[model samples]
Target: MAQGTLEVVLINAKGLENTDFLNNMDPYVIVCYGSQKRKSSIASGQGSEPEWNETFTFDVNLGDLVSPLRFWTAIVVQRMTVLEKLCNIPLESVMEEGKVPAAPYNVVKDQEFRGQIKVSLSFTHKTHRHGHGMAVQEESYGGWKQSSTY
Candidate 1:
């Protein structure tokens, strides 16, 4: 299987639906790529627009049909409700250009457009070697790890 790396930049979000009425929403992202998930730090009183400016990296396999890189992001509202919107991110762009510049993607709920979130992605092709003596190291995400056997 062809292996590589996928870099995700969690830029910021704007015009989000304020789920918190008493105070500004304490928004954070639960980034899930397959079984592994990473939780971002709360934006505090940032309210409708939260800027994380954080970067996350994940290993990807072009040959795996269901690689861990298959992540669907969901913005949690009140840390309970699913404020995630379905957005199509073309993996092909990463294959060709190797990077997707930071841009805004529409955020929706119940088929209604609610807001936008900006993100950027990049891919680095890594050579995979198969030999009798080989090793693969894995990282744990929030206690979740990708199962692999040598």
Candidate 2:
């Protein structure tokens, strides 16, 4: 059987208001996994120039997100819209618990932006149900330990 992967793309960001101030925000991508006891994989990207716009794209295994369709839909509709309206998305954009919003990007209505950037991510999915929650283990070279076991 062929493996399934989720492809995420960051569309254009537009500023709702006009301003001369430079919005130095970058679009970020995140993958959420599990539910009731969820976890997330967050990545940061650069922003567009003061006069140019950019897009970000990423791919992930469908199984990575507990409810891939539901979660992604919410991100596309709610968070993205809000971020565009705000004109700037901070690196510390992710909120507390499972309340993290979509990655934000810098945009301006009239001001020229020569500082835009793009990012991409890709990962495979591995489905393993652990009932209560899922656990991830990572091994590092230094000491062959799972120290940063996020």
Candidate 3:
């Protein structure tokens, strides 16, 4: 097992079924890993095609190298109802190289299909000291990217 950081870029959501009766639904995302939970800002009136471009980080201790790491994602409306739409990310796919492809999840209301949310994820391992107490080789492009918003 390796202790490191997991980076989740909450890029955007598309084709989300509007839940509000009279207006466009206000939607946000809640991401969970172990005991850590992070949320993206609500996409005010973006309706179905909402873009967040938000990033969340979690401290992770990866146990199995062969299997994928899993996390829970839920799309919420008005911060009250938890839409039946849920997503689980396979971290191993995005751990070493490319992005996690946007996959569709079933959104349900009264047991009927509502819509979907598209998300992408990426991960990078943290540098650790060697047995000889020497610093590990650092990758120039492997740290957190600074953002102006939070």
When sorted by lDDT, best at the front, the candidate numbers are: 1, 3, 2
Model 1 residue 105 distance off true place after TM-score fit, in angstroms: 0.7
lDDT of 2 at 46: 25
Per-model TM-score, in order, reads 0.71, 0.21, 0.68
29 Cα displacement, candidate 2 (Å): 5.4
Report the lDDT tens digits of candidate 3 across residue range 52-79: 8787888877654433333333445556
**lDDT by residue for model 1 (1-150), tens:** 456778888898888887678777777776666556667677878888889999888777654353433323444455565545435455666655778899888877688987787888887767444466665543334335456666
Q: Judging by TM-score, tell me the better candidate of 1 and 3.
A: 1
Give one digit per residue, the lDDT tens place, for model 2 in 1-150.
112233333433333221212443333323232232111222222232212222222232222223422122011222342223223332111111212334434433457452222322233333433336864332223324334322
Q: Rank by TM-score, descending?
A: 1, 3, 2
Q: Higher TM-score: candidate 1 or 2?
A: 1
Give the count of colliding residue pairs in each prediction: 0, 17, 0
lDDT of 3: 0.61
- Model 2: lDDT of residue 124: 34
